[model samples]
Target: MAGNTEPLSPRAKLAVTAGKAAAAVSRAAGRGSGSVIGGRVALKLDPDLLARVAAHLDVVLVSATNGKTTTTRLIAEALRAAGPVVSNALGANMPAGITSALAGGSDARYGVIEVDEKYLAGVARDVDPKAIALLNLSRDQLDRAAETRMLAEKWREGLAGSKALIVANCDDPLIAWAASSSANVVWVAAGQEWKDDAWSCPSCGGVLQRRDDDWGCGDCGFRRPTPQWALSGDYVLDPHGAAWPIRLQLPGRANKSNATMSAAVAAAFGVAPQIGLERMWDVTAVAGRYDVVSFDNRDLRLLLAKNPAGWLETFSLIDPAPAPVVLSVNARGADGTDTSWLWDVDYTRLTGHPLFVVGDRKLDLAVRLEVAGQSFRVCENLDEAVAAAPAGRIEVIANYTAFQDLRRRVGN
Candidate 1:
C-alpha cells in the first residue's frame, strides 16, 4: 500500500526539507543539482498539494521535450514584466526542486515553474497551477521510462491537473490530443514546416496526416484542429529576414517558438500580448542553455549541448566541415550513465568534419564518431583537447557531465 505522508505546506515543507537537501548538495561537490539526491523523493505519496499551493499564489507550469527550460525562463521574464513573479531560477523542475525554487523566490503575484514529463502529475498536484503551456513532445530519456506517447497517456489519466487554462501547441499531436481531450484549452500552434514530421498514430503505429501545420492520424482518424492563436509569420534572418521588423536576441526557429510561447501564456494571464512580446524583444543570453560565449578574439563560439536533441539542433547552426571542432562527451551522475541515445543522434553528418574528441568515455564517443567515417583526436580529458584544437573556427560540444571540465579547460 502507498504510504500516506501528510504533505507539508509549501513554505514549511521546503523550509524543513531543503535545509539538508540543499546543504547536502552544496557540500557534496559545491554544485547544485548534483548534491541534492532526490531519487527517493520522486516516489512516495503526497496529497493534493496543488490546491494548497495555489491558495498561496497563481502558478504557471511549463513542460516539453526539447525547449522547456529556456522557454520557462522566457515565460517568467514576460510575467515579471506584467507584475512581480517568482520562479525556479535554478532549472529544477521536479517536486523537490520546484519546492526549493518556490521556497527560495520572493512571494510575488505570479509563479512560473518548468517541470519534467515524468514528474508532472505529482508536481501538478503539489503546485496547482492556474495555467499550463504544453509544448511539443518528442522522443527523449528513453532509458529512464516509456515513449512520448506513453507519457502523453499518463497526462491523459488526469495527472492531478489544475485544468486551469491550457495553452496547447497544436502542431504536436500528443500535446494537441492531451489538451483537446479536456475543456477550456486555448490552442497556440506554429505555422507550416514546423510540423513537417509529426508523430504517427500512437495506437495503430501508422503515419499521421497533416492539413497544413495542423495534423491527425488518418488511419486512426484522430485530428487536432489548428490553433487559433497562431504566431503565423515572422522576419527570419537572412538576405530575406523574417517579415516582422523586430530584432531577436535568441536566433533560430526554436528560440522564436520559446519566445512566442511565453508571450501566449502572458496573454492568457491578462498581460497585454504586446507588452509580453516587447519584453521578449529585449531578451539577451542566459548562462548555459544555447549561450554564446566567445574566446580567442571571437574565433570560436562555445555552445553547451547537454542532450541529444540539443546537439542535433546546435550542429545545424554550425558548419561541422573543413573547420576543426571538439566534441566533449562524458558520464556523470549529473548527465546520467545512459548515453544510449547517442545512437539515436545523426552522427553521420558530423563524420566529414575535422574533429578532436575528449571526455571520461573518450573511447566510446570516439568509436561513435569514427563509425560515421569521421577522424578524431582522442584525449584523456578536456584540457588536452582544448590545447590541441586547430587554430580556426572551432566549436566545443560539451555534454552536461563534461561541461565542468570544459569550463575549466576552455575558460570561455
Candidate 2:
C-alpha cells in the first residue's frame, strides 16, 4: 500500500493492485518472492506501469556485469539518510523484477534500482533517473548476455541524450567509452581487476596501451579519463582531493570499489561521502552473498561468482590457503547454458588450498581445475563437500543457481 499519494488512473491502479495480490499469492505458495511474476502480471495489465510508478521518485540506475546488486543496496542505504528509499534488495535486475520493486515503493522519495547489463538502456529510458552509476563491465553469461563491447555500444546508444548525471568508472575502457557520449559524467577511478575483456579499445579496434593504471589507444584518441573521484587503498578521494576512509563490513577490494561507486552516486544525490559510507557500514551481506553458515561444525562462507570476471574478483575474497574451498557451478538457464567460462578462471591461484567441486557442472569445473594442474575432489552434493572439508572456516563459491541451491540447503 506504500505508493504515490496522487491518484493513478483507474487502469494503473487496478494493475498495481493485481500485481500486489499476485505477489502475495506467490509468497504464500512458497515459490519465491514473486517480484518477477508480480511485475509480469502488472505489465501485462498495464505496459507503462514502471514509468508511471517511478514518475514521482528520484531514481538512480546501477548497471554492471558484476556487483550491481551490492552497489544498488549500498546506494539505497546511503540514500535512506535523505528520505524513504526503495530498492530491489534482492539480486533481481531485469525489467519485471525492477518494476515490481518500484511499484511496491511508489511513495518512496528515492528509488535505487539494480539493472541487468543488457537491459540498462531500456530501464534507464523508463526511469529517467537523476543519476546512473556505470560500474566495470566484463564477459559474463556468454550465451545469454551480449559481449562486453556489444553491451558497451548498446549502453552508448541507449544513454545518448539522457539528462541524468552519469557516474562512470574511467579505469575501465569499455565503461569510459560507454559513458563518453554522455554530456554530463562524473568519472570515478574505481579499479578494474579483470582486464581480459577490455584489452581492445571499444571506440577503435586497436590494442589498448597500458602503463600502470593508465590505458590509451594509439590508433584512436580514446584514453582513460581523469577521474574526479578515485579509490586508493582503503580511502576514497573526493572531487575536492579530500580523502575519506572506506570502512565497510563487506570483504575484498571489489566491494571497496563498489562502495566507492555507491558513495559517488550518493554524493550526486546531495548526501555527503562520510554520511554515505557510515550508512553503508551497516550492510554486512547482500542477497545472502558473503553469508557464513555453520555446517557440520565448519564455517562455510558463501560467495557467488557467475563468470570468469566474477571468479577473478572472488578469488581475492577467499580465505587464504589451508582453508578448504568448495566450488559449485551450474549451467542452468539463469547461469547460461554454456560452462566454457570455467576455463578462463585461474584455478592455479588456489594451489595451496584443499578444493572441492559440486553442482550440475562439477565435471566441467573439475576438468578445468585438472587442466590448471590443481588437484580437487568432486563431491556429489553440498553436504558432502562441506563434510569432506576439515572442520574450520571454509570458502564456498558458486554460480547463480548453484549459489541459490546451496544457500537454500544451508537454510540461509
Q: If scored against the real structure, what TM-score would every candidate get? A: 0.82, 0.98
What stretches of model 1 exceed 4 Å from their correct place?
1-29, 33-54, 159-161, 191-198, 210-214, 232-246, 294-300, 408-412
Measured by TM-score, how close is model 1 to the native structure? Answer: 0.82
Index of the highest-lDDT prediction:
2
Lowest summed-lDDT stretch of 10 residues in model 2?
Answer: 1-10
Q: Give candidate 2 regions above 4 Å deviation.
A: 1-5
lDDT of 2 by residue, 19-60 (tens): 889999999999899999999999999999888888888999
Q: Please give, for residues 61-166, the per-residue lDDT of candidate 1 as tens digits.
A: 8888767777787888878876777777656677666654554443466878888788776676666678888887765545664677888877766633456787
RMSD in Å for model 2: 1.8
